[model samples]
Structure formats: C-alpha cells, structure tokens
Target chain A: EADIYQTPRYLVIGTGKKITLECSQTMGHDKMYWYQQDPGMELHLIHYSYGVNSTEKGDLSSESTVSRIRTEHFPLTLESARPSHTSQYLCASSLGRAETQYFGPGTRLLVL
Target chain B: QKEVEQDPGPLSVPEGAIVSLNCTYSNSAFQYFMWYRQYSRKGPELLMYTYSSGNKEDGRFTAQVDKSSKYISLFIRDSQPSDSATYLCAMSGQREAGKSTFGDGTTLTVKP
Candidate 1:
C-alpha cells in the first residue's frame, strides 16, 4: 500500500460550497502532485509542488488552488464548487523528479 | 497535440494469457517512462518504471522502452483475474518541475 493518504474517500456536496481536499504523505517526499480523472478516462495534471512554499499550475486549467506550507502536506482548495468539478482527485508524491511516485487512495467528489 | 497517446481498450483475455499494453509519446525530451495500475474507484499504483531505452523485468511484469521510436510497453506474464484493472502510461523529462503526462487508461479484464 502507498504511504500517501487522502481523507474523505467519497464526498457529495451542493454547488457553490467551499471544499478542501486533504492530502498528506508520511514518506517525506519533496515532490507532490494533484491529478483530476474522469471515470475510466485519462488523468489531467491540475497542480504540483516542488517543495515548501512552491506550487505551480499544471497543463490543465483549474479553478482550485493548492498550498504547500509544509513538506509532507499538499492540500487543494476550491473556493466555490460546481457541478463540473465532480471527478476523482488523486494525490501522489515522489522523492525526487525521476523517481517512482506513490499515490493515495483518492477522493471522489460529487457536486449536485 | 497531446504528449502521450494510448488505446482505450476494454481488452478481454483468458486467465494465464500474456497481456500487452502500450503507449506512444510525442515528446523527445521524455526519458522516464512508467506504468501504473488502478483498481476500480482507487488511485493508481505504480507497476513498472524504466529510464531511457531498454527493458526491465520485475516478477510477472516487464517494461520495455524505445527512445528512438518514442514508444513504451508493459507485458504481464501469466495474467490472472486479479490483474484486471486500468493500465495507465506516464512519461516526463528529467527536470523536477516538468509535469508527467498520462495516457488514457486501458481497461483489462482477465477471465478464468
């Protein structure tokens, strides 16, 4: 099993509600990433962090923002959720750039 | 154009049959290739990782990378029913900041 952990394996929320998806890694990895995936489809990189206080947006445009105040923690926040935001969000971390990445269980979000 | 391309296959095969999954990448700068397996409603798990060109074997899984052709493959020997899942191919450059591009996963169903 991977060392990364994501809370609320499943979540259903109303539209326009503020939500935060938590991701934490105990493996002491420096590189963290967030990906959004539709059911049985490709995963799109949404956000990533190289180290503390360093975060960058990925190829895909996302309304959410992420912060990396600590090395082991990278949380994604959506100020106001929408129906289009319903998807599976995966969290992963790697020790370095070219190393193997470990993924968390993922958080499934549903907006109604 | 997208950096990585893969067949979104619902490939069905009998148990104990050898399974082959492949992906093609457009970026010549990509040197690290990886394959990840994701179960239903779960995050993806790394199955194989290879650097540059060559083949690497681990247990029932073998990863092959061809830098010249910008192609990579994952072969599973003696596939079992438990091996049924979505296989995703990912690749990226050496830089720590470069985002890893993932292909649309191929779903495999192994039947006994």
Candidate 2:
C-alpha cells in the first residue's frame, strides 16, 4: 500500500488567511507533485518536484508555491487564500518519470 | 483539444454488472497509461497501469491500451458496491518526471 499522507484532511478558513498543506511519503520516491481539482473537473497540475531542491510549475497557473527541502515532504503554501482557492488538493509521488504515481488521501480546503 | 479526454459520467449500475470506462488521447508520445479510483473527498489511488499497447488484468479489473488509436479502456467485471468511485485516466510521455495529463474522470456507482 502507498504510505503517502496529507495533513488536515479538511480545512475551513476565512479569506486572505495564509494556509499550508503538508504532504509526506514513506515510499522513498524521488518525484512528487501537487494538483488542484474541483468537483467533477479534471485534475490540474499546479506544481511538481524532481528530488530535493528541484521545483517546477505545472500546466495550470497557481498562486500557491511548493518546496521540497527533504525527499519525503512536499508542502504547498498559499500566501493569501481566496474563495476561488476552495478545492481539493492532491499530492502524489512516483519513482521516476515512467512509473506509476501513488497519491495521498488529499486535503479539502474551504476558503470562506 | 485536450491531451486526454474522458466522459464525465455519474453512471449507476447494479452490483455484479460489468463496467466499462474509456479515455482517448491526442498525444502519441504518451508511453504510460494509468487508471485511478478516487472516493468522495479522497485522493486517487492507482488502479491499473499499462505501458504502450495490449492489456493487463488484475483480479476483477482489466485495462486495455490501444496505442495506435490513442484510446484506452478499463473493464470491471462482477463489480461490487465497494467499487463505487470516480475513475480517472492519466498519461505521461518520456521525459523524466514528465507531468501527467489527466482526464475529467467518470464517476461509477455500483448499487447493491
């Protein structure tokens, strides 16, 4: 089974508040990713990292930023949350480019 | 056009019924194909993975990939009510840490 985990499975916060979503994996995967998904919509990739200290923006434009200081942890931070930022955030990891990705339980954020 | 396309279906089926889900892609370079199942408010879990063409089966689930047509399918036989979830199709190309492109997902409900 995948050992990936996400913190604060559900969150409710006021607008303009700063929030951080934590993701960690015990599988020792080298690559990690963060995606934003709305109900009934496709998952849009926002950020991804290749091992430590390597981060890149994904296909979608996102206000949140991610850091990969350690191989197991990838955290996403939104400086100022908004109503539009209310959506499910998923974290995933893979051994390499062509490998299957394993995902965390996900975090549902509500920016009221 | 989107790289990958899938029907956004809230399809309801009785238990033990056969479930067929499909996805089409425009990117011929995509070498890896995958199916993921996500429950309500949860992140996706990798259900199946296929490389290039042909079929792969795991228990009640069968994944078929037609690289020539850029079409892929997942068939679930004797599906149980526990199988109810959103099924997403994802694909990636040859690059290391290649970002995956995802479909909108098809929601399946197997009612007992």
Candidate 3:
C-alpha cells in the first residue's frame, strides 16, 4: 500500500482567500504529481516534481503554484481562490517514470 | 479528438453480475495502460497496470490490452456493492511514461 496523505479532506472558503493543500508520501518516491479532477471528468495534470528542488508545470494551465523543498513533501498553493477552483485535487507519487503511481485520499476544495 | 476515449458509463448492474469496462485510444505510441478506481470524495487507486498487450488476471479482476486495436478492457467478476465507483483509464508511452493521458471516468453502480 502507498503511504501518501493529504490534509484538509474538505475545505470551503470564500473568494480571494488563500489556501494551501498539503501532500506527503513516505514511500521515498522521486516522481510526484498533482492533478485536478472535476466530477466524472478526466484528470488534468497541473504540476509535477522530479525530486527536491525540481518542480515542473503539467499539461494543464493553472493559477496554483507548487514547491518541492523536500523529497517527501509536495504542497500546492493557491494565492487567491475562485469559484472556478472548486474541484478535487489529487496527489500521486511513483518511484520512477515507469512505475505505478499511488494516490492520496485527495483534498476537496470549494471556493464560494 | 482526444487521445484516449472511454464511455462515461453510469452502468448499473446487480450483484454477482460481470462488469466490463473498456477504453479506446487514438495514440498507438502508448505502451502502458492502467485502470483506476475512485470512490466518492476519494482519490483514484490504481487497480491494474499493463505494459504492452495480452491479458492479466488478479483475483476477481481481469485486465486485457490489445495494442494493435488500441483498446483495453477491465472485467470484474462477481461484482459487489463495494465495487461501485468511478473507473478511469490512463495510458502513456515509453518516452514519457509518467505523463499519461486519461479518459473521462465511467461511473458504475452495483446493487446488492
């Protein structure tokens, strides 16, 4: 089993508020990714990290920012929340590019 | 057209019925195919992963891949209520294995 965790299982906040979604894995993985998913929709990659100090933007464009200061911690930050940002954020980690990605429980955000 | 296509089926079936989920891709470069299951308010869990082609069976789940047809299938036998969830199909190539293309998930309901 993958030991990945996300904090704030559910979050509801007003527009213009800042929020941070936390993701951490104990698997000592080198490749971590962040995906945005709407209900029943395909997952869209937002950001990804190769390792510590190596972060890259994903296929989808997003206003959120991500950081990779530690190998195990990968956090996503939204400077100002909007209704459009209301969706589910999923975090996954894998040992390498060809490895299976294990996901967290996900963090649901509602920007009202 | 999208690279991966999956029928966003809200398929419902009774317990003990056989469930088949399928996905077709336009990209032949994709060598890796995967199936994931996501519960309500939770992240996706990788249920099966296949490299190349052929059929792989695990317990009550069976995964089949036909690279020539650019098609993949997932079958669940003796489906139970706990098997109800959104199923997602993802694929990637050897060049960029972690940058997978995903299909819109299919929602399934298994009634007991």
Candidate 4:
C-alpha cells in the first residue's frame, strides 16, 4: 500500500468556513497533485505541485489554493467553503511526471 | 468534447464472473494509459498501466491499449465481491509535470 495519507477522512462544514485539507506522503516524490471528484463522476484536477514552492492550477477552475512547503506535504486551503465545494478531494504523488501515481485515502467534504 | 470518455456504469456481476471496462480518448498525443480502482470513500489506487499500444496482464487483471482506435480496456477475471469498486481510466502525454485526463469512473459491484 502507498504511504500517502489525507487527514480528516470526512469533513462537514457550513458556508464561509475556512478549511484546509491536509495531504502527506512518505514516498519522497516530487510531483504531487490534488483532484476533486463528485460521487460517481470524473476527477477534476484543481491544483498540483512539481516540488516545494511550485504550484499550478489545473484545467478545472477551483476556489481552493495549495502550497507545497515540503516535498512530502501538500495542503489545500479553501478560504470560504460553500455548498458547491462539497466533493471528495484526492491527493496523489508520482515518481515522475508520467509515472503511475499513488493516491491517498481521500477526504470527503460536505459544505452546507 | 472531453479528452477521455467512459460509460459511467453501475455494472453488477456475479462472483467468479469476468468483468470488462473500457474507455475512449480523443487525444492521440496521450502516450500513457492507466486504470485505477477506488473503493467507497477511498482515493483511487493504480491497478494497471500501459505504454503505447498492446496488452499487458498482471495476475487476474489485463490491460489493453489501442492507440490507433484511441481505446483502452481492462478485464478482470474471476472477479470477487472484494473487487467491487469504481474504475477510472487516465491518460497523459509526455511532458514535464503533465496533468492526466481522466474518464468518468465505472462503478462495479460483484455480488456474492
């Protein structure tokens, strides 16, 4: 099993609340990604990082931000959570850009 | 059109039966194809990966890629209830930090 982990496997919050989803890995990978998925839907990449201090937005426009302050840590922050932000957030890490990625257990958020 | 397309199947199969899942892509530039399995609220886990075209088999799972037709397939033999999960197909081109495009997952339920 992969060593990647996401904290607070499930979260329920109200609108306008600030929330941060934590993702960490012990694989020493340089490429990390964050994707949002609805129930039985396609995954939409929201943010990704090549390495520490390198972050980029993905194809899907999102209201979240991420920071890669450590190679093993990538955390996403939503300044103001809304009902539309309710979805499962997945974190993944790969040895390289095109390599197979290992995913965390995911955090399911329910914003009311 | 979406880069990758897959039927969102809530497919039900009996135990010990063979299950087939498929995905189609519109991007010819994609050089890597992968299959991921996600259980319940967990993040997706890589099940199989293929480069270019042809077939690759691992244990009870077989992955096939056909670049000419822009189609990919995954077959699971003797599938069990434990194999019940959502299957996602992903692909990406050769680029540094290339983001992968994913198809809407197919949910499989292997009944006992």
C-alpha lDDT of all candidate models, in order: 0.91, 0.92, 0.92, 0.92
Q: TM-score of chain A for each candidate?
A: 0.97, 0.97, 0.97, 0.97
Q: Candidate 1 at residue B90, lDDT?
A: 89
True contacts kept of each: 0.53, 0.70, 0.70, 0.70
Cα misplacement distance, residue B62 of candidate 3 (Å): 0.9
Better of 3 and 4 by TM-score: 3
Candidate 2, residues B21-106, lDDT tens digits: the string is 99999988888899999998788888999889999999999999999999999999999999999999999888744468899999
User: TM-scores across all candidates?
Assistant: 0.97, 0.96, 0.96, 0.96
DockQ of prediction 4: 0.69
Select the stronger candidate by DockQ from 2 and 4. 2
lDDT of 1 by residue, A33-111 (tens): 9999999788988999989999999878999999999999999999999999999999999886555778899999999
Arranged by TM-score with the best first, the candidates are 1, 3, 2, 4
**DockQ, all candidates in order:** 0.63, 0.69, 0.71, 0.69
Total residue pair clashes for candidate 4: 0
Give the Å error, residue B69, model 3.
0.4
TM-score of 2: 0.96
Candidate 2 chain B — worst ten consecutive residues by lDDT sum?
Answer: B92-101
Instruction: Give candidate 4's whole-model lDDT.
Output: 0.92
Worst 10-residue stretch by lDDT in candidate 3 chain B? B94-103
